[model samples]
Target: MESTTWEESVTDSINTIYLLFSAYLVFVMQLGFAMLCAGSVRAKNAMNIMLSNVVDAVVGSISYYLFGFAFAFGVGDNSNPFIGSRFFALADVPNSTYDYTFFLYQWAFAIAVAGITSGSIAERTQFSAYLIFSFFLTGFVYPVVAHWVWSSAGWLSPSSSDLLFGSGAIDFAGSGVVHLVGGIAGLWGSLIEGPRVGRFDAFGKPVPMRGHNATLVVLGTFLLWFGWFGFNPGSFDKILVSYPDAADQGNWTGVGRTAVTTTLAGSAAGIVTLFGRRLLVGHWDALDVCNGVLGGFVAITSGCSVVEPWAAIVCGFVAAWVLIGLNILALKLNFDDPLEATQLHGGCGAWGLIFTGLFAKEEFVIQAYDSGETGVTRPYGLFMGGGWGLVGAQVTEVLVIVGWVSVTMGPLFYALHKLGILRIPVEDEIAGLDVSSHGGYAYVAHRDEGHPRYYADYMRLQDQS
Candidate 1:
């Protein structure tokens, strides 16, 4: 008995360390978000956007600690399908079922949701509005969605006693829960704010308002890619649990496979986008490829653990077209999102959930959902002959996420707009937020003796010399 206790203690320690490392990796994605948002906007708005990203982390930490974690994972004697009511302010934490490490891991995810939304309204939103929405989103709107899908008492949870359609939605790593929630929220915010000034010409023609630096965009993309290894594989939450039928294999095997699928999906999408954009626009563009890579990652995140590697490649292939097609539609509709947050995270994220419904393997599903322990096999991928139950659940998840975020975030943005605090003024936007609102340009070369046109004057003088 003593030897058994010792073994269990070692396993617990190892799992704790694993979760903490994964949380750290996920935290690094915040830096990636900062760089990506900074690079994707004009240099004038770089400081503003980067500052919002910073605020997302800081505000998200406090809010999630005080309420978001409880709303997302807190359980009580009278557990409900929607929203948690315990552990507020980290009260009664470190219990048997949940620990500090778990809270830290979840907090990382909560911040990521806010980061994704910040990209949609970049360049034109008021900083005060950013703070209000970030706090509300990370603390309330997002946590409700997390509860519905991740909490054991959630109606949509696979672990729920009464599963939706006998197989709850398989958002293995939050394609719907995180990416879709963020994306849909962004969609509402962008739709209400309209396009950024100068994004569309007088006659409704599209204008290419490119970012100032491509190097930063590339750097940010790579950092996000590196962080995704933690985002997907780390969702497993443990690497020590062994499967009953498999000899010398466990969740560790699933973790490795998830990482591989993530890599292949992103890589395939990047390659496809590189060539697809060349054909569409007669030029190779790295920015398009980077967005495509992220889109693929977003799509495959739902099924990274349950789908085969080849299926992941297919997911990426279709995901590239989905992003390309969405971009074209966004341009036609005159809907301007600076980071393509809605299309990449919203559209591709929806596709990822469907892909899971179509391609998830039965055995992998059993392993991922812990159905083997219950001895009750759940429905899986439609194409794999597991039937329509799982696919129906996936479709339901998409529809509900769209409905939920739209209902919640849509009105908040509209109210802010009505109150005249959502978007910046025309003069401020035209002069660039950095000069009019943020006090200075992100690049020092643009700042010359407190004059706005200093860089241009300096250039002309150098030419004369």
Candidate 2:
């Protein structure tokens, strides 16, 4: 093998470090999701919710390492647009350090997809079934969709000759690949698992099942917001390798612009949601605000590197409105999503993709185009005098992703249902999964007299008696 040049070695080291740092930030999202899910359920099921989050990281890591990574991104020339053909069980890579860093980053993304599905079935689903679903989801379902968009050979990606419109689909940070796939899977899971107990009333109106802790929810939301900095900016992957030289300041453009747009979009959505909530219900809800912030993040993710800042604000504001309407509509249609993952991710993710097609600037798109690395030109957006081709491509992606996830996950969940493992026993659910499934309460401060924790403490006190 040829010896590496000093510049190449330095650039590789920098890339690895930056990717790992970004992965760390993304990994922190697991904590945010855990706390968020825990806060969204009743106190009785809090442990179960937190445990599921833990499971996402553990199972997701192993599964992705085994097959998920390979399926999503193959090693060497085995990778194709439709699917990856090698790297099973994480066979050794040629570039161990850099490859491993990339794997770690992608691993975090796989875990996130599983974690997103967990909240929709919270408080009612069986742990065993969720474990199974997570394995397959990361191993296959998610990878297939990811391959279609992120892989160099993907038909819908800029690299493929099968481009549908303009420069093909543009998902700067997985508005469709990550958030949409997760949201659609959650939608199907909710439908198959059915609503949580007492989710609907005798009059057929949706009944609210309020989350136990608002403080935790807000805290989790803040963490997620913080993580978005790494998420949106890190997608460039080019910024990290650029040295701060006179001519190299341009490298910072994508990272800086993405960060700014991400912040503005999230902030704009939060503000819009606050007012929208008041006008609709005469009261503002903390949960709604949190979801609004997340919705905005999802909405701007696809366009953050390509759109102007003002367009980001418009995306966020509209995302809030869409979320509000989508939530109400889901309730009316009997779809139960405790964390509103469906509306926030599904609705906002689609909007992000479409919004990019409308508002993406010509120069920014060109900057991010990476000189046909994906095999397509950086087509301008409609509002930039580019016409409707990009918009059409985005819409096509949205429809294809929705259909793909639904078809794959819907049946899998239904089969799990047939096996009698899809959900816990109704009695177990009513009494709470913590006591019945996990054998403990999440909060002991308010435990009933003779609760298990107290019982355990009492028994320990009399040990050897």
Among these predictions, the greatest TM-score belongs to 1
List, residue by residue over 196-258, the lDDT tens digit for candidate 1. 977988999998877768888889999999889889999989778887776477788899899
Candidate 1: misplaced stretches above 4 Å? Answer: 1-4, 86-89, 96-98, 371-375, 448-465
lDDT tens digits, residues 1-465, model 2? 999999888877877787888888888888899878888887878989899899888998888888887777774677777776555846633258877887788888888999888888888989998899899898888887777877776777855667657487888888899899899999988989889877887777986678879989998999998888878887776554343233454546578889999999999999999999999989978888999999999999988988889999999999999999999999899889988988889899999999999998877776675531333355778888888888888888899999988889999999999999998887677667887888777888524322344555533432422
Candidate 2 has a TM-score of 0.91
TM value for model 1: 0.94
For all candidates in order, the CA lDDT equals 0.88, 0.82
